[model samples]
Target: MNPVAIRDSYDVAIIGAGPAGLAAATLCAKGGLSTVLFDEQASVGGQIFRAIEETPVTDKRVLGASYWRGMDLTRAFRSSGAQYVPEATVWSLTPEREIGVSLHGGSVLTAARRVVICTGALERPFPIPGWTLPGVMSAGAAQILLKSAGLLPAGRTVLAGCGPLLWLIAWQYLNAGAQLSAILDTTPAGNRARALPHLLPFLFSGYFRDGMKLLRAVKREAPVIADITSLRAIGDDRVTHVEYRRGNGAAQRLAVDNLFLHQGVAPNVNLPMAVGIKHRWSDEQLCWVPVLDAYGNASIDGIAIAGDGAGIAGAEAAEWRGRLAAMAAARALGRSVPDPEETHVRDELARCLRGRPFLDALYRPARIFRQPSGDTVVCRCEETTASQIIDAIALGCPGPNQMKVFLRCGMGPCQGRLCGLTVTELIAEHRGLSPQEVGYYRLRPPVKPITVGELAALPKTDAALYAVTRM
Candidate 1:
């Protein structure tokens, strides 16, 4: 798609090309609205389905049938007649529905009648000892490497933490013939008993079958260690060994070089929060999510948030949400569009999410894993330790915003993406408040880091240039 040929204004602009954004853009364009899709990735598939079109993995069995489902969505999006701007980093959004995006060699401001944010979820904060070490990486990051480059960890790789993604990655590693030394399960022992009631609801959800396949595959190949408590990485320069204890037992050490860690995922609320949208704290999910109506409309009138950015329902539900949000947007704009099978879609969405309660309860990370203890580094970009955050709370820092002033915790290049949750939880635990009362980092544009050259090259005096935050 030609960037110069793209219009400065649209009937609707969708920020993100994941399943949610892709579905929304396709439907909105098909409804006779000029729709444009923007994404930082080189392709349409978001993190869950990275490199769908260009993946070198020929055998679909390696990635499973569910992973291949994104191909159909991307195919539909390609032929949906919507303008797609790949590698465009949307930084700022205004109440007037204008988006500030950095693309190609410079930045541009695009206006739309309505904006839909589907920027999706990010991995929950995994702040543990030696997390900032060189070889330490999130399980999602490791999967991205495998998906995009067909690469896997070379040396002995230890998979730790509790999540579906953790087990999925281990299965993928074994499928790809990579070395996996051990699988250290961090799931608390009582998790199964606690999640037992929710298990009945998920029995007919279709995910149970797939979940069993992954579980059996990983268990068959990998050395499994269950009921682990308190894990730590140890090394001089990089992670060389992992230490852990199990239920008041003596600490056991495992030799390792590569460590993959995961807890769970939370909504990526940075963009919506930057736009000054009202967010509510999710007590069950243990994170803050944008306040959205049934149709995915946010607190703002013309803005809608879909996908996991609204919550953590995973990818299938996000696709249904994308379609629902677009249908709502079409109706709001008075565009005559074919009605979706609302009842069927809603039922499928519910079915897709039926397993979440069980999963959330089963995999809730231990407090030490999420908040950590001692001087473990919490903020990778700023090298801010958990102790520094605790000290800030002791000094009555209140929340992440104030703690940012006391210590440069969330002000680094990541701009609080990595450490925001940890800091908020730390302060909340210290002050005896909830994550809601102790709010997250206050974000301002430019949300993504941009080059000075990009700013200098902006066409000044153009009335279309969106007003940036000034001192």
Candidate 2:
């Protein structure tokens, strides 16, 4: 994918091309703001709507009704007159609204009057023994292949972990006529009981009916093992078998060519955190999330976070959040958004989020899964094991930052994106403190790795020249 021509500045800059970013760009551009949208992917839609334009999944049933919704969003965004830059990385975003984007191996420095980060969410790390094995991957990864490339695993595959995504993936694979060996459901038996209080609202929401349909479809085609208290992938170089234990029962192993794991997703917070957005550990979601107002404005002025990056309210809510944030940005830029329009977006967003608490409760990952033990590898990038993290804590490491000093747990190239939550949870458990008290990694920019050549190749302005030479 070739890069689009970039301007020196824009009225609004969106850092993702998912539902939120797309919706925000459409609104901003339609409102007469000179808007620019940057997405690292070759296309938009983040994960949920990935490959909305390019996917080869001709049968809508394969990807489902929810996915086809992105077609309308893409159509709106393309016609809205916003500059859409595909294969672009907005790696460094400053609090003052400067954006450093890399395209075709070079960096472009641009600015915006107001910035909306819609980087969306990442699959919460599912670290287990042998997860680092070659054939093992995330369920999200598998779905990406099905969506983007119309590809599926060649042999028997096992889908493990708990979350709506797990079932969705299983159903997708089934609908696509792919082979499914089994599904290892690790949802604790008590989760349903815990989720019951929130049930009434969940049943009334739009998701309930659709979710039940997907659930029934998946269960009918796939063999499901429930209450899987433990899981492991077995192989020397690549996962050849999936071993799991149900309840307190003896372990069982199934030969499988692919092992896809998921425990839901958390906000993709690296860029926002690097930009100094205030964040807190979400107790319900079990991950770090940005602190934002109702309009998605963050702690810093001129910066707002929408979509799952604000919190995981799913894709429809993300689109609404994007509109809300765009409206806030437009207002901040001295543009007027009609009161009724703002109220409608706000109301839609509320309706979308009404069932979120229930979903969060029902799908909350178990503590044992969140905090691994012994030989389980916690940080895949650093090869930092759960035992290693535990030893650091036992040796008086107070938190993730200090543990980094002791074991280099979060300093790998991926920078704690994979291990940050795990390390925080491990430390919290050891110290008998909450994740909030334990805290997250102190992040910095450029959030994504950039080449020295890329930085030096940056169009050398007065400030750029000054920074390279003290004289």
lDDT of each candidate versus the true structure: 0.87, 0.91
Q: Which ten residues in a row have the lowest lDDT in candidate 1?
A: 462-471
Error of 1 at 17 (Å): 1.2
Please report the candidate that would top TM-score against the real structure.
Answer: 2
- Cα-based lDDT at residue 455, candidate 2: 85
User: Which residue runs does candidate 1 get wrong by more than 4 Å?
Assistant: 1-4, 461-471
State how far residue 462 of model 2 sits from its true place (Å).
4.2
lDDT of candidate 2 over 241-264, digit per residue (tens): 988899999988999899999999
Provide the lowest-lDDT 10-residue window in model 2: 334-343
Score residue 186 of candidate 2 by CA lDDT: 88
Question: What does the lDDT read for residue 338 in candidate 1?
Answer: 73
